[model samples]
Target: MVSKAMHRIDQQVPVLPIGDGVARSARQQQRSPYLYTDDEIQRILHAALLYPSPKASWRPVTLFTMLVLAYCAGLRGGEVARLMLGDVDLREQTLEIRETKFFKNRRLPLAPGVMTSLKHYLVVREQAGAPTNPESPLFWSPQRNCGYTVGGIRLILTDVLRRADIKPARGAVGPRVHDLRHTMVGHRMRDWYKAGINPQSKLPYLATYLGHKDIRSTLVYLNITPGLLQDACERFRKNGAAAPQTRESLP
Candidate 1:
């Protein structure tokens, strides 16, 4: 197998970094990521929490927990699906995301409300008699008897979005479930900018939290709009021409 051959070669000689090996095609412009508004996010969560039940299924709690984590932590759907019981520390209010995209591990802290929901889910899960072993999946499926799959989670999210009446922009490609991660970053930047904080100074922290390889990757998630531009112009005027250029105005 190629993997075995690569392993054997690696043992004999250090493997050379081949890079991604894909050629970048020149495009007219970068595709913008879709961002969710606060009301839409609330509706989405409400729909997820109200996922229809046979009156006893744990699907509602599982879906709710998954959505909250994805939005708050900027986690990829697969990362949420792959979480294990040992990865979550309710006491510490942190999640250990292990061996994720780019072969990196990171720690994600939960918001207080999110942690409360997780604790409530855990209580429900325990009462339902789901396995609580460290290696067991943190988000388990009662019917499938396994951890939630990426496809499964996607389907649920799609359904939740539909129920919430959140639609993609006319002729736009996205508003994909993964856009929740984009929304988190974009919203954070907007908040910082509105607060007169320099978002550029905090880019690295956001990059680390989102498990991006570098700030360049983080920058791809930011989309400048007329509103952001207007805010920057207003801030400049307020500062009497001494205002620093904001990250939003950077090329």
Candidate 2:
């Protein structure tokens, strides 16, 4: 977790620098991959989303809604804290990010599958007589003034991670929400590749869509795997390039 002191600094820091670091990491890791094995990430997100929790009478709908928004929309923990009852448009199939952690605004396009689930959830919400106003918060917790906190998001997934028994490879960092952001980027890149999309050119669009200030901030999500790394090394040679290496985090 970022200490409040760190958060204050990050808030003041220019986002482009963050993007630069992200891009440099990707370039540096061309020889060695610096990411979870695909299976590990898949296991973590699925387990977290599926793990059952003690639902309030309205929790089933709220929980499902939160999962769909977080996974499909790629919202950060704080943007989610600001989700309002009317921020979502089930009919329009898009949602607006008012103000985000990095101070970027975006409109996340939704697909039909997610829309279907969201509609189901909204119905339950309506049955429970929830609000449909832009003013009212979409997800409220009795404990929080506005919405869920970083710690809350962490606890939610940590409990599920324990259930799934997913651990870091020896000497790897434990998984976290930012990891979910990484996983989503990796998944999208794979999809673009499969669809004959030129990843280099497509990256800017993806960056904008993901609410990144610039492509550099978005490129960190592109750290490749061993097989992809081998392919890069065969074509491009960079002096002193590192494999995607991860430093160990203290337990």
Candidate 3:
């Protein structure tokens, strides 16, 4: 096998070309995460709510609730898919995410308004007589008799983006459910800057909130956008912060 040959060559050559090429390819193929503006988020949510009759009649409420949670909580699609009925604590305004990405558990506090919306969704679910057992999925699907699959959610999200008239150019990646997390981070960072808070100091808390094992992992979620860049630069100028001058080392 090529892998075995690579192992053998490692002992002989002290280095491998395969790994370098793969790393280079990965760097070249990396795509930026799509960041949604406030208007775009509202538009997408509206589109989901307006999803056509019949098939989507069963889904509008569920999809809208899911979108709110994804954007507000910055939950990964898989984490959102795995939520159990007992995981959501309306009284405490918290979500218990268990055995997530790194086999870690975390509690995420909800915004007051987001909590209210979730309470409304729960009331509707109860009226519909959807399952309420502890083991039952928080987001139930009438079609699946269980929680929505991550892939299923992604497919639905793609359709919603299309309906919202959001299309990525040719050969470019479009918005996805996961991008909601990125958008959440970006928006939060922008807000922190505007509020005169040091985002760097709060990154550890954000990492914990997002269930990332290390701060390094959380950094990947923070993408720089034009608006974020402009706002940050303006804040810096307002604060009278100066760029550090670099000193050349003597040759």
Off by over 4 Å in 2: 1-61, 142-146, 167-173, 227-251
Instruction: Give the range where candidate 1 is weakest over 10 consecutive residues by summed lDDT.
Output: 20-29
lDDT (Cα, tens digit) per residue for candidate 2, span 152-194 = 7656655555556664433223554455566667766666655
The residue pairs that clash in candidate 2, if any, are 19-217, 32-243, 32-244, 33-244, 34-244
- Tell me each candidate's TM-score: 0.79, 0.65, 0.81
- Model 1 has an lDDT value of 0.81
Q: For each candidate, how many residue pairs have backbone atoms clashing (under 3 Å)?
A: 0, 5, 0
User: For model 1, how does the per-residue alpha-carbon lDDT over 67-135 read when each residue is reduced to its tens digit?
Assistant: 888888899998988899889897799999987898999998888998999898898888777799999
How far off is residue 185 in model 1, in Å? Answer: 0.7
Off by over 4 Å in 3: 1-29, 53-58, 168-172, 241-251
lDDT values for all models: 0.81, 0.63, 0.82
| Best first by TM-score, ranked | 3, 1, 2
Residue 163 accuracy (lDDT) in model 2: 55
Candidate maximizing TM-score: 3
Q: Judged by lDDT against the true structure, how good is candidate 2? A: 0.63
